[model samples]
Target: MSHLRIVRDEPPKRRERRPHVNHVLTHAEQAQARAALKGLRNAFGSWSALAAAMDVRITTLMAAARGAYNVSAALLVRASRASGLSIGDLLGKPIAADRCRACGQIKRRVA
Candidate 1:
């Protein structure tokens, strides 16, 4: 039998760890934001498309989602309309009735 050739693989390099930024929100907040993003995406497809339709920059919504900025209740309402969702849905809050507050009609998420 021929002598076996020995080859040792190098260990993988450890990734450089960066210091955590204080501006980032806690895990819980990130979860909520992620949920909100899911709801929004379900409604409007993508943030970029939704922003284009709403005439707002995508970065604005991104900033809000990442906790780098805050959006007002009114802006949230507008975004809700733009995304074909309700404010409660966008915020991951459940509406008690799931009915239209305007006309008392049964309503779905988008319509």
Candidate 2:
């Protein structure tokens, strides 16, 4: 009797898209988040220090970064001011999230 060996030959699964939470930040927003995080770190001199200054738990900041949630406008403004980026530059043009991202048509939200 010969022993048979079974091997599973399957490629690793790749997710197409990851849905964001209540606030869906665009890809650009994600990039901005990275810059903002860097600014935040630089302003406070370190991640641990920033957390202390902001009175937020360090884990919260880490989670926000891991999840790719863009900092809120208020946070962005504060970070921009701290990091030497003008508010105008940080905001750029107003980008509304109320439009259908695929076609840019306005859509009403369900109540």
Candidate 3:
């Protein structure tokens, strides 16, 4: 009788992963986003109207207004356009230095 030999393949090595980072909005930013959405809702006089204006579902707008979920950047841009406010204002940041000339600090460019 002859003894049988078996060959097995080695397992692949695992890759290293970097530590996770928390990118969720802070409490204050969440509140600001919620307030901005709510104000838009109020302006439109109904959730459905606001949703139509934003082209999002009424439930989504409601949840965002109630702070049930983090408001996305695209949603914020829609709100900004409908409200005539800049994205910076929606995010509670001052407008970019170049676009804001009302402060009288930015000099006019000579063309």
Candidate 4:
């Protein structure tokens, strides 16, 4: 006589958590990021190229450049190293400025 055996399936494993996702940048910071992205994009000719050179994702680079989200510091270092530029140069200079009535603060454009 032969005996029959039953087997049970295991549950799927959960993915490890990444850094805090939804950490949006401030208005001024967004401006700076966009400006910096412009220069980096120019150098690489495209967001994909830049991200590829930095070993990161194109979407991440695009979002960071468009000010849609903040970039990781490690990515920043990678960009700077890959471009042979300092952090200051990557984050281009400001272009315009205006006073805020609500907070009585001055905001400047980053070019």
Candidate 5:
């Protein structure tokens, strides 16, 4: 009996593409994001840690924290949910956790 050997060829390497720059945040939005990041940093210790808790990449967190890039509303929603803060809160609104997210009216505690 005779055995045959087969040879496999390696695939061509792909060229590395530069990272895409999608959007840039406005001054107001940037300030809000930075301030929120500051609050989060106190709790999470670092951007990487906060990103892990937020279920997002470190780069995404960094961009949002630094306001170096525009972030999607979805990301904001995720960050708000993860941080237990409303979107307005993350946006630097002077609302407390006891207040309604939209109207900012304080909710009475139920017995």
Candidate 6:
């Protein structure tokens, strides 16, 4: 009589969670990001051109523009720098009147 051996499959591994990696934007934020992306594309004349200016993949820009995925803070920073738009604008946050437009620092009152 021949002995039979049973084969068992290994359990699937759990994915490691990275903190502060993916940021899920709200509907309003998503709309703001989409609009900012559109403005960047128009300024650059093409998505590929804008992607090149931002130092990111064209597909990343395309996906962000389409709202297919979450937009990262890094991407927004790049967009802000490339398009001269504030990060607050991209995230749909209002710019505070007390904040400086160039540096975003609050103005100090003189005594």
Estimate the lDDT of model 6. 0.77
lDDT tens readout by residue for model 3, 3-111: 9977669766789998754356677777787877876676678889888888899998899889776787678888888767786677674333334424636546689
Model 1: lowest-lDDT 10 consecutive positions: 93-102
Candidate 3 off by > 4 Å = 1-24, 93-111
**Residue pairs that clash (backbone atoms under 3 angstroms), model 4:** 95-109
TM-score of 6: 0.60
Query: Lowest-scoring 10 consecutive residues by lDDT in candidate 5?
Result: 92-101
Q: Candidate 2 regions off by >4 Å?
A: 1-20, 68-111
Name the TM-score of candidate 2.
Answer: 0.42
Q: Can you tell me which runs of candidate 5 are displaced by over 4 Å?
A: 1-26, 93-111
> What's the C-alpha lDDT at position 54 in model 4?
87
TM-score on alpha carbons, each prediction: 0.45, 0.42, 0.58, 0.55, 0.55, 0.60
Model 4, backbone clash pairs (residues 3+ apart or across chains), number: 1
Under the 3 Å rule for N, CA and C atoms, how many clashes does model 1 have? 0
Candidate 2, 1-111: lDDT as tens digits: 999978779966888896755364567775666555655575567878866665556776666656544555555554555546565554444334354434668878689
lDDT score, candidate 6, position 62: 95
The digit string of per-residue lDDT tens for model 6 on 1-111 reads: 999988669866889987654646676887777777876686678999999989999998999888887777788889988867678865664445456656889879699
- The TM-score measured for candidate 3 stands at 0.58
Q: Which structure among the candidates has the greatest lDDT?
A: 6
Error of 6 at 102 (Å): 13
